[model samples]
Target: MSHHLASLMVAGGLDALTYSSLAFLIASGLTVVFGMLGFLNVAHTSFYMLAGYIGFSIASRTGSFWLALLLAPPVTVALGLAAERLLFRRLYAAGHTPQLLLTIGLAYVIAETTKMIWGDDSLALAPPTGLGGHVVILGATLPVYHLFVIVITMALVGLLALLIGWTRLGMVVRAAAIHPQMVDALGFKLSAVHTFVFLVGLYLAAVAGVVMAPMLGIYPGMADDALVQSFIVVVAGGLGSLPGAFVVAGLLGLVQGFGSVFLSDYALYFPFVVLAGVLLVRPLGLFGRGGA
Candidate 1:
């Protein structure tokens, strides 16, 4: 193969990795919240978009990318927690239709708020100091920030696995997801668990937003796009399965990246195509519970 062609493929693969990784980070929170509570949060991506805009605003004001990264996700998490407490708490058992509509309304409110704050124009965020350059990996020159994103995301996933798999908190969250009544009977506060887990999920969304801000920028329409992509990931991977989301999001991300490279005009359809195929075969999703 020509050197140029090989370089193109490598770049495409990296792009795919980047997209898949970010998609997982963003979608996992929604998946977990649904898995445990069986309530889909349509406003989740609003948190992601808010994080990006917040990060950009801070970065632009202070001229410090590190500060933005450090500050944005926490702020978004706090906002999400507030929304959960004041708004979502009232709708936990209201069925999917009402929750969906209300969250959509909430998302709309958030989008308008962002427009009022940041204007309608997209805003750029520079990468942090050490990540402002490229690095050679496997004979390919790649953006250091991209590599940093991939590595940090891997660690994030690992930490998540440990939290959910090895810790008491994870056990409680999983048990609650599977059987809230049983956990309640066992003397645990189901509401507290739900609130805590929801915050964790929103925090993950914010992390994804902050991490991707440099590449994606802050824009008015980002919330809508992110919502679509995250929903696809959650549904395709299975409603409540983080591992399933990781695998499916990775594959779909690759499909999107390579499709855009090899078949640019068709790239936009890849996500829906994958989603349709997944639903046609396994309506419950790849790892979704039969009860779910």
Candidate 2:
């Protein structure tokens, strides 16, 4: 292989990794919320977008990306909790229609509120002082912030695995996802479990938003594109399946990154094509359960 080709491949791979990292961050939360609640949170990406805007505000005022990162997720998660307590909790047994309508309305309201506060103009956020540099790998220049994203995502994946696999809360969450009535029968508060799961899921999205702010910038319509991409990931990976989300996220990222180079004219359509193919083969999704 030629040196230049190797460099190009490395660059593409890194870009794919970065994209996959972001997708997984968003989709993981969405899937978890769906898994526990048995309904998709349509406003999930709106929370993600909201976090970016909030993070930008903090960073701008405090002049510290780290501060924004530390503070933004909790703020976003608080709003999610508020929505859950006041709005979503009422719709738990109301079926998909009510849940869908409520969430979509919430999404629109959040979007409009963000525009009112931040305006429609896009805003750029610079990386932290230390992460502003780049390193050469396989003769390709790789940004340190991208590396930071990949590393942080991997760490979170490990943390999530431990949380879901070994912790009592995780066990309760899994049980609730499969058999809510039985969980309620066991003297556990099903509603509390649902609320906690939602909190964790939204926190993940908030973290993703703050982390991605530097890379993607803050904008009004950002959540819509993110929503589409993340829905594709959740559906393809199997709703509520973290491993499925992770695998499909990597695959979609590679498709987008390489497609942009090899099939530039139709690159934008490639993800939807992948989604169509997945649905044709596995209507329930690659990792989704029988009913889901």
Candidate 3:
């Protein structure tokens, strides 16, 4: 009985790790954008879904996973620019409710547009040539594609940490995050910083979509659940706190991944429940310091 219990725990841990990797990929971009811009950007998940479609279309036509990976980010960046210039900028000073409404509306528009372009059917992509098998570890079989997801997510996180910690742009971003009034008083172009941050967020979302499309088939409302999940992650991790986002996202992913095995009917809500509990205990979240 003890041996069986230990094996189950090991399997659950591996599964949690896999799911956490996916969640990290999905949430990191959200964390960065929200942390920097102070906007919820509800349409973030739409970008994720769109990237999956874009990648799928490209790969299906060209049979080149590399092309899909390389092309999706730039395309999403362009879209993000347009969105910021045309829509989001207008709501920047309109207060949070208005901004939230605008973003929610944009989410619907993007979803509908995606449906018109890709139809209401589901789509999938094959893993790249090199990452299309399984490997065994600790008496458990794990998909190679998941391994790729884990590696890519960890690399991106490291790169982001370096960029934010050691680079000029990162310095500006950190300054803005810590002291927006001071940054603006110093004559920094806050608008440009916001635009750059939005673009990067969109790029990350697109990459996640492309990579995850193989595992999760793309559909019309594919981003709805993701959007909710990410919001919970953001809230639970603490608003505008990147490190907090990473921690909460990993925690939620582990709970959802493992909880599903035991409570499939309520698994999807597990993260939200955790979020609620966290909010009740520490309203500012684990990492969030009182005001941005």
Q: Highest lDDT among the candidates is held by which one?
A: 2
- TM-scores across all candidates? 0.94, 0.95, 0.92
Put down candidate 2 lDDT per residue, 107-181, tens digits, no spaces. 999999999999999999999999999999999898999999999988888898899889998899889988989
User: Global CA lDDT of candidate 3, please?
Assistant: 0.80
Scored by TM-score, the top model is 2
Give a tens-digit lDDT track for model 3, residues 1-292.
7765565566666667767776767776787777776677888898888888888888888999989988986887788788889989988877778888988898999999998999998887779997888776655566788778778878877888898899999999889877888989999998887787778777777888888887877888779878877888787888667778778877886787678766779987788788988888888887877864
Those runs of model 3 whose alpha carbons end farther than 4 Å from true positions after fitting are 1-7
- Model 3 deviation from native, Cα RMSD in Å: 2.1
lDDT assessment of candidate 1: 0.87
Q: How much lDDT does candidate 2 score?
A: 0.89
Minimum summed lDDT over a 10-residue window in model 3 is located at 3-12
lDDT tens per residue, model 1, 132-172: 89876555677889888888888888898899899999999
Question: What lDDT score belongs to each candidate, Candidate 1 first?
Answer: 0.87, 0.89, 0.80
lDDT of 2 at 253: 84
TM for candidate 3 is: 0.92
Residue 122 alpha-carbon offset, candidate 1, angstroms: 0.6
Worst 10-residue lDDT window, candidate 2: 255-264
Give the per-residue Cα lDDT of candidate 2 at 46: 98
